[model samples]
Target: MQKVEVSDRDWKHLLDLRDKVHVPGSPAGSNSNPCMSLYRPLAERTKPFVLAQVGQSLDGRVATPSGDARNVSGSDGIVHLHRCRALMDAVIVGVGTIISDNPSLSVRKVKGPNPIRVVIDCNGEIPADAKFLNDDGESVILIQADDVDRTINGTQAVKLPRRQSGLDVEDILGALRKLGLNSILVEGGRRTIARFLDAGVVDRLHVAVAPLIIGSGPNGICLPPVHSLSEAQRPKIDVYNIGTDVLFDCDFRHQYQQT
Candidate 1:
């Protein structure tokens, strides 16, 4: 674990955050808790913790129709992302994100250890020359549905049962936990986030809304159809301003889960 020396101003900000944090049994509004986790399925409490993040435009689009989505969030938002990546044991993304963004998924902007990179490539689609496989020291784990055993450029491939939707999330998490990972950050394209959400296994959701709006593009989360507002999800949100972007840090497990 790395130790950071907080400045007085940062310390004051920490003090101010106390009232902004909210948890189920905690005070109505408190941000004092430095760490927050999603409510795990009873069986998954022993599994690795999971958190998902999304950066969308004001109109809820992750990318434009042409599949261009670079720098949707400002530098501050980008830094916030790297910081979050810096704190996790591993960072996960769907194959679609890799094809679209070709993200390095490393903690370059922040001062912390780089985490294990997890890619959900159910099909064997990722090209052999993918940049993620080139990182010499960083650990890369690819979850694929294909039964053929294979390895590419030093990347370890974990085979799991496949569903029409994608690789089995439960099996994926189980494999990750078995690898000794205690926490994971799920950062991705829409389908990936949807899988975790539909599974009801996500513990935390961090949404950073940029100031711009792209009238049409890919939506962030593809949830099931709901008949009325009463059935809609109402998460307990903690708001924060990261430069020009606004963050909606939400804990869905407590608000939506039935005890």
Candidate 2:
């Protein structure tokens, strides 16, 4: 891992570089660009951490009227998405997203060691044919609520019972921590991201805001209502523009203190 304390000027330069390469409505070229170069270094600095990466439309929608993947973001954004996968120690998503999208959740374009694939299946009911169950490049861990038969190939299944309203976020994080993963990336549909945020577990947030607007669809986050309006002020983000996409970089520690 590259070791260097990043200066404020370095952060500003990185943001400028991201803006130049993360062009909206354009296909990312084959060659490495300013965005990748800038992000690669910053990602290195965020070791033993967690980052929440998500994409949403201008109006805060992550899907189409009928839940189709339509115009979420251009190829440039997708390329950046892969960069997140390459940088983190592991990738996490809820079972609902796994069943709906059937994502292989691998780092394809960028050449780097693939992170461990994690599925938050509260009920140990992942379908036998899920791609992560068969992928060879990275190991898969299914976090569930019951003892599942460990006969599945290319996957390690573990059980962690739900606490209160949903799967215990603290337990899931503990398990990831036990696996020697210092950093984790939470890639999600909606409900999963919300759970992480609501549980006060997400350490950072990287929201890629697409230019298009989807009037009605699944929200990018489905957080439970805060006990009161005052309780909702837990996350205060520092925003940066990546071309048309806005990245909301937040540190939950500060938010927790403020709350």
TM-score per candidate: 0.81, 0.76
Regions of candidate 1 where Cα sits further than 4 Å from its true position: 1-47, 256-259
lDDT tens digits, residues 87-132, model 2? 6778999988878778888988555557899988776667888877
Q: What are the per-residue Cα lDDT tens digits for candidate 1 across 159-196?
A: 88877766778888899988977678899888899889
Best by lDDT: 1
Q: Relative to the unseen true structure, what is the C-alpha lDDT of residue 122 in candidate 2, on a scale of 0 to 100?
A: 73
Q: Tell me the lDDT of model 2 at 251.
A: 64
Candidate 2 residue pairs in clash (backbone atoms < 3 Å) = 48-182
Best by TM-score: 1
Error of 1 at 189 (Å): 0.8
lDDT of each: 0.73, 0.69
